[model samples]
Target: MPHIAVIGGGPAGLRAAEILAEAGHGVTVFDQKPSFGRKFLMAGRGGLNLTHSEPAPDFLKKYGAAETLMARAFERFSPKDLVEWCHGMGLKTFVGTSGRVYPETMKASPLLRAWLKRLDGLGVRFCPRHRWQGWEGDALVFQTSTGEAVRFTPDATLIALGGASWPHLGSDGQWANIFGKADIALSPFRPANCGFLVSWSEIFRTKHAGEPLKPVTLSFAGNEKRGEVMITEKGVEGSLIYAFGAALRDAIEAKGKADITLDLRPDLSQEALLKRLSAPRGSQSFSNFLRKASGLSPLALSLLREGQKDLPLDPEVLAARIKAMPLALTGTAPLARAISTAGGVRLDAVDDHLMLKARPGVFVAGEMLDWEAPTGGYLLQGCFSTAAIAAEGIKAFLAPA
Candidate 1:
């Protein structure tokens, strides 16, 4: 059996290790961290979203520019395949109202534990705290926890080191330097599915920071998403904002800023809102009167006011403002704090099977590749699908006739 080395123990690395080991290859999984899945566990803290239940076409579009590259991987292991894989490991999964899939237990610990046990049963060896340095001749070099450098010569290698995000979780994008030194083509990393910075006034920041705006719709670049968003001390984040993260980040990069329109009351038509606002207010304060009329929470009211210096008295103007509150995002949050990142090894650097064309037998998978997707279960699904494709590539490369 061919001895294969799978580097980086995120979802992609671990999943590829499982596949290669089960295929009767000698697989060794290595991770820089002491544990195998730090980010995976962190992702589960907010009810692990495993994958989405959307149709393949819609799901594939989330990858944006990399849709063509991801299409092949999905054919090898789609979201439905991922769900079945979870079931095969004795874990039950359910689809959320938003169509995102989650484990029945709603946590990653159980699923991770079961997965590790299966890999162990398959005789897969793990080397934790093995920080990959670079190539030493034809052998891979690693710095162990003890600061001792070691070398390994494997029949093939699969790299699944994640992109530059959540540095504390071990995906620091330091691998880019090594790959660059190796003359491999790469794309600069940028924060994705992250918050955008908004210059909030002192009063607005003080009052609404850390609050949530719900049942709202945000429109930008001709795309709209209706969900909840959180107002951070620095800017805005959460599921709603993340849907437009890539576009906003790109716009800010090119034009120094991006403007998005937020509908504070998506459920209410502007005309209906105007009719309600036209109602006579007796002794009640204007704030209370508007609050009751629009049925907006204090957070939504504050956000609406952020765009308008003074709440308009004209019912039509106020209704229009409530329906479309413009927000200017100055920049994106720091890469370290971003939930995920885009741009890595250029897809052109890898063949259709995910093997690096320049370096035969070296396969790339997961976020390490150039593709990126939004937060809503797409990230994990992308990792799994790519890993599966790379594993098949490794098998083909190892046992060529």
Candidate 2:
């Protein structure tokens, strides 16, 4: 049996190691961190959204252009399969109202604990704090915890080192240089599913720093998504902003700013809003008037005040502007705060099976691949799906008979 080396202890590496070890192969997993699943644990802190319960087609579309490439991996081990696998390991799951599947325990710790036990029983080995530094004369090299160099010559290798985000928990993207030297095209890591920075007036920042903008429609570049966003001391983030992160991010990257328009009342018709604005204000406070006539939520009122350059203006124009409030996002919040990463190994550098074209016997999987998706379990879905595919590819390569 061939000995396989899986570099990374995140979802992809763990999944692949379990599969190979169970199949009677000697599998060893390596990670620089002392423990496995740091990022995975952080992801579960908010509740482990494993995969969405959405239909397969819609779920697959969440992957964007990488759909065909990732679909192959997912088809063999789809979201339904993931739930079954979790259940077999004594982890029960349920689908949320938003269609995101979560464990009955609602925390990834229970499921992860069971998963690690299963892998241990399969004879999988885990090497902690072993930082891979790429190949050294046809042998893999890593920096040992004791500041010594160690080498290995496995029959196959799978690199799921993850993307450049949340460096404290590992996956610092320091591995990017190794691939660049290996002649693989590297997509510079950037923030995905991240918040954007919008400079709000000091008053608004102080007043509504942690406020929630619920049931609002945020539109950018001709696309709109309806969801709640949270106002931060520095900027804004939430389901709606994350849904259109790429569009806003690209605009900021290219033109230095992204204009986003928010529809305070999406459900109301323009004529109806105009009628509501035509009603007499009778010199009531701005907040009280908006609450009584416009029916804007508290958060909406705060946002409206922030956008209002000059108060006490004509009610009609004010209402029209409030109907479509424009705000310019200056830049990204920060990579460390990103839920997932945007850039990684470009697809052109890898074969259909995700094997690095320049380096044979080396495969890539998980978020390290060049693809990004909105949250709601899609990110985790891609990780496990790609790992399954990598396992099959390794199987074909080591023993084609």
Candidate 3:
């Protein structure tokens, strides 16, 4: 049996290890952290969103520019396949109303525990605190927790070091430098699914910061997403903001900033909203009247006022402002603070099976690849799907002629 080294004990690495080990290969998973799946556990703190329930075609669309490569990955292992794999481990899964899938336990611990147990049963080895340090000739070098350097020569390798997000959880992006030294092409990492900064007035920041503006539609460029947005001291965030994260981040990189429009009442037509605003105040204060007429929360009203201090008296103008309130995003939260990362090994840098073109016998998967999707289960699915492709590539590479 050929010895395979799997670096980075993330979802991708672990999944690949399981597959390779099941094929009767000797597989060892190495991680910098003392334990595996730290970030996965953090992600599951709220709820472990495994994969999306949308049609495979629609789910593939979320990968954006890397759809071609992701298409190949999904062909090998799609979302439905992913859920079935979970069930194979005796983990029950349910589809959310938003079309996102989650284990019935709603926690990553149970699933991860079961997965690790399965891998161990398949004769996979786990090596914690072994930080990969590029390569020494054809041998892989790792610095153990005790500061001792160890080298291992394997028939094949799969790297899934993740992206630069959540550094404390083991994805610190330091691997970029190592790959760079080896002449492996990679893109500069950027924040994805992250919050953006805005210059909010002191009063608004103080009063509305940390408040949630729900059932709001956020429009950026030509894309629109309806969800809840959290008001932060720096600007706005949450699922709605994350939907436009890539576009907004790229726009900010090209230009100085990106501007997004927030529709407080997406359900109401402008004409109907105007008609409602035309109602007589009848001794009600301007704020009270606007609040009652627009059916907007106090936080929403305050956000509207942030655009223009003096409320417009014209019902039509007020209605238009409510329908499309522009908010400027100055910058994105730091990569460490982001939910995920964008920009990694470019698509063309890897072969059809996700083996690195510059480094044959070595494959890449998960966030290490240059692809990003929104938070709703797409991230994990991308990781798993690509891992399946990489494992296939490794198995093919090691096959005896």
Candidate 4:
């Protein structure tokens, strides 16, 4: 039987190991951490978003520029397939209101435990605390926790080392240097699904830091996202901002800053707002009048003040401002603080099967690849789908007739 070494015990690596071992290959999974799936478990702290319920066509678009490449992998293992896989493991899954799928327990531990048990039963070997160094000739080298170097020469290898984000969880992007030595082309890693920095007034920052702006619509470039955003000391963050991260980040990179428009009251049309604002102020204060008219929360009102010094008294002007309040984003949060990362092994460096063309018998998968998606379970789906594709590539490479 052929022996395969799968490095990095992330979702992609583990999934690849499962496929190889099921095919009757000897597979060993090496992870630098003391245990596997640290980040996966951490992601489940709030709720485990396993996959999405969006149709494949729309779902594939979430990958943005990598949509064409990702479509191939996703076609082989789509979201429905993922849901079935979860069910096959005896874990019940439900689609949330937002079309995100999660385990019935809403935790990753049970699912991961079951997956590990399944892999163990398939005769997969796991080596914890074995950090992969680089290659010594044709042999793969690793530095153990005890500071000893070890080498292994396997029939095939698959790398799913994840991205640079969440360094404390063990994926520190240190592997970039090793890949560079091999002359593998890699894109500079940047923050993705992350918060942007804004220059908020000290008073607003102090009063509204951590306050959530809900039922708001954020628009940037040609895209619009309706969700809630939380005020942070440095800027704003939340699902809405994360959806527009790439466009906003690129705009900032090109022009030093990005101006995004926030609709404080998405539920009300501008004309309707104008009609409401035209009512007499009566005895109500300006803030109270605006609050009663437009249903603007205190945080939303403060955010509006951040953009303009004086509130317009004209009903049309005030209504228009409320419909499209502009906020300037200065920069992005550091990569370490991001939820995920953008940029990795450039797609051209790898073949159709996800095998590095320059390094045959070696495959890449997951966040380590040059692909990104929004957070609504798309990231996890991308990892698993690409792992399946890479596993297929590995199988073909190991048996070329």
Please tell me which predicted candidate would have the highest lDDT against the true structure. 3
Q: lDDT scores for all predictions?
A: 0.92, 0.87, 0.93, 0.92
lDDT of 3 by residue, 285-388 (tens): 98889999999988888888995759899999999999999899999988899999999898889999899999999999999999999999999999999999
Q: Which stretch of 10 consecutive residues in model 1 shows the poorest summed lDDT?
A: 302-311
On TM-score, who's better, 2 or 4? 4
**lDDT (Cα, tens digit) per residue for candidate 2, span 332-387:** 98887798898889989988778888889899899899999999989998999999
Off by over 4 Å in 2: none
Off by over 4 Å in 3: none
On residues 1-401, what C-alpha lDDT tens digit does candidate 1 reach at each position?
79999999999999999999989999999999999989999999989999999988999999999898779888889998999999998999999999999999999999999999999999999999999999988899999999999899999999999999999999999999999988899999999989889999889998888988898999998888899999999999998988888889989999999999989999989989999999999999999999999999988888878756688899998899889888999999999998888999998898988898888989999999987788889999999999999999999898869
Question: CA RMSD for every model?
Answer: 1.0, 1.6, 1.1, 1.1
Q: Candidate 4 — worst ten consecutive residues by lDDT sum?
A: 301-310
Work out the TM-score per prediction: 0.98, 0.96, 0.98, 0.98
Total residue pair clashes for candidate 4: 0
Candidate 4 yields a Cα-based lDDT of 0.92
Superpose all Cα atoms of candidate 2 onto the true structure and report the RMSD in Å to 1 decimal: 1.6
